[model samples]
Target: MSASVDIRSVSKSFGDVHALDGVSLAIAPGETLALLGHNGAGKTTLFRILLGFIEPNSGEALIDGLKAGCRQARRLISYLPENVAFPKTLTGREVVAFYAQLKGAAASEANAALEQVGLGEAASRRCGTYSKGMRQRLGLAQAIVGNPRILLLDEPTSGLDPLSRNDFYQLIAGLAEQGTSVLLSSHGLSELEARASRVAILRQGHLVADGPLAMLQRDARLPIRIRVKTKPADAETLHREFGGRRINGASVEVTCEPDEKMAILAALHQRPGAIADIEVIPPSLDEVYRHYSRANPDKEARS
Candidate 1:
């Protein structure tokens, strides 16, 4: 089955460099959470703490109600680091089988995991001969071999091609459907925008924002850009009446607060045939990420 992860009041420091400061977050069974931050923003530090690679100065991280680093808790987790490495001499199948052994899975599942990541065709090939994308797929195969309860992926699509990335996300979706709690860390905000069920943004080692996509967008209160396409003859009139600027000779661009969207649309519809098409563009995930990441920038550089 899946697992629940709770990080409570977790703080960590390396001498004077504070990596994380009282960050609290949780992921429910079968939920996919996106952990977003820039370099030195404590994303990796938090992951490390969760993995039990380092102890937090205060508070605790729990997996399935057990303290992190305990054998039972460790057994329930799988991780894919930003940079995946394998013994160059081993074949892809051998590498996956080795990891499966570590996770207490049957060695035979190695081929199955390879197939899931589209690496079965190259399973027998030496990892040293694989391309970067192929290596990424190999990493995915190993990470998924044991049917882990919780999966942590950092920059999982770093070197993947468009097609490979699509496959990777599809596999992750299936895993989540089966009750796996997924914690994904990536700089690809657009990619995670649609995939993650919730987003947690960190800034200067602090948890700056945490919520579902729609909630964060509403809280951001960013303007929604609406592009109205009309006949050349009606463009100027619509622009003048709507108070929006005219663009491209045949379009009027209007921006309104999220709550004002429907009102503006009703007003436009009142002018029948005044508009041919309307395209509404809401604040993107990247925009929301930037809003919180910079909300409380400190003078000291984040480690």
Candidate 2:
């Protein structure tokens, strides 16, 4: 039941501040979209508007063609807020079971969901006793019940440890394999770099960039790092020919534009056996985020 999310010409304002200005984006089924922005950049406001918590000043948010928050849309959409809450008295199993019932699913389904999130051994533990990561996994279990068509997550992995965070993303990848669309807002740029199929960045409520990671990197025109390893005896010769900064006795690092990448590689072939090894690192997500943020600093200054 994977479904698409469409935000069309959406805008919102609070007094003298504009939270969103004609923001538009479409998330396809099975796609993972990472929403990037700083505090007060309208990321949360956009999520709120998409979930229909507040009305947009203009345009609309739709779930697979149905109006957001409508009976059909509600059935297909699920959400996990940045901060999760639960009844202190309820056991993990009970909490999942209770919420499943609310969503018209059975207790057995709850057990399966708990098991899916690696919480099977802790299903009987009381909510108050669960660790922060455990609570997050429980919240994820809640969001995915009934195989929701789309999942909206805000800072979903905020407090998770490295291992737990890896587990969380793996679970999400499996869900996407089953065609579940995901829209997650986060500050974890490096983490999201490889996971998100596309990224839509928000600055002061306006979308400043939207596309696949590679495309955005090219658009940013950021430098790509190229490193080559050679013998210490030939390091000077290679440096003279390749024109890059030498690292140790055997490596040199060169920063070049994307268009120059192929030409640089072609020249490397000329050295042949003289070069022992080489590596090229593209612009990181951090650099990509910084590029856009700097370009749109005007809005942040206004607020």
Candidate 3:
């Protein structure tokens, strides 16, 4: 079964610096929530609070309604840090087995965990001998050892190749299907577009946006780019007809509501042979981030 994570008005500070300020959000069971922000944002601090590595200065962090950092909360969660470190003297297999034993699983289960991350063949190799990507896989294997209900990953795809990244996402999708809630912090906005059910954007120490991807995009006032394909003359005519501005001779761009997308298509369809293709381009998360960041420079500069 999956567990939900609830953070309400959580604040954390280090000396005079505020790392997280009144952060509050809820991630439901079996959902994947992507955390986005620029460098120095509170992404790392938030993850640490969830993992019990740091105590919040105020408010609460809860897993399944239980206070975070309790034994019950620890048992239901796994964490994959941005940088994974393993004992140099230990073999990959030994490290995995050690974690399984700590989790009260039979040592024999380690091999299965290694296989799940496609590292079975290298299980006997010393941790010092593994490449960066291979070491990342080993860390992921350890996190998945007991099928914990909640998983927190920071830049999970870092150091992974294209194929490996694709496979990793597929694995995450399967975990969600099996009812494991995932919280992933990533800088790769494009990848999150397909992987995350919802995204929360953090600027400095504050959460500037939180909701489903579609909803966030809607609330961010993102522009939609429209394209119509036709002959140069027809394109020009259509551009004039619909007041479309030419991105090029054959392409036009417009900002409009998502629901109006079909209307644009219909307008072109009404004129037979006037259009060959139509496309609607939604704003990327990066663009949306810039929009908010620029609008609130002072707030975003605190961190």
lDDT of each: 0.86, 0.85, 0.83
Model 3, range 244-290, lDDT digits (tens) per residue?
58876887666677678778767667886777777777888777767
Highest TM-score model number: 1
lDDT of 3 at 236: 76
RMSD per prediction, one decimal?
Answer: 3.5, 3.9, 3.8
- Which regions of candidate 1 deviate over 4 angstroms? 1-3, 272-276, 296-303
Model 3: CA > 4 A from native: 1-3, 234-244, 248-250, 270-276, 285-303
Estimate the TM-score of every prediction: 0.89, 0.83, 0.83
> Per-residue alpha-carbon lDDT of model 1 for 212-302, expressed as tens digits?
8788777878789999999778998898888778889999999999889999999988887778899999888788777777764552123
As for model 2, its CA RMSD to the true structure in angstroms is: 3.9
Instruction: Please report the TM-score between candidate 1 and the true structure.
Output: 0.89
Query: Pairing residues by index, what is the TM-score of model 2?
Result: 0.83
Q: Ten consecutive residues with minimal summed lDDT in candidate 2?
A: 294-303
- Ten contiguous residues with the weakest lDDT in model 3: 294-303
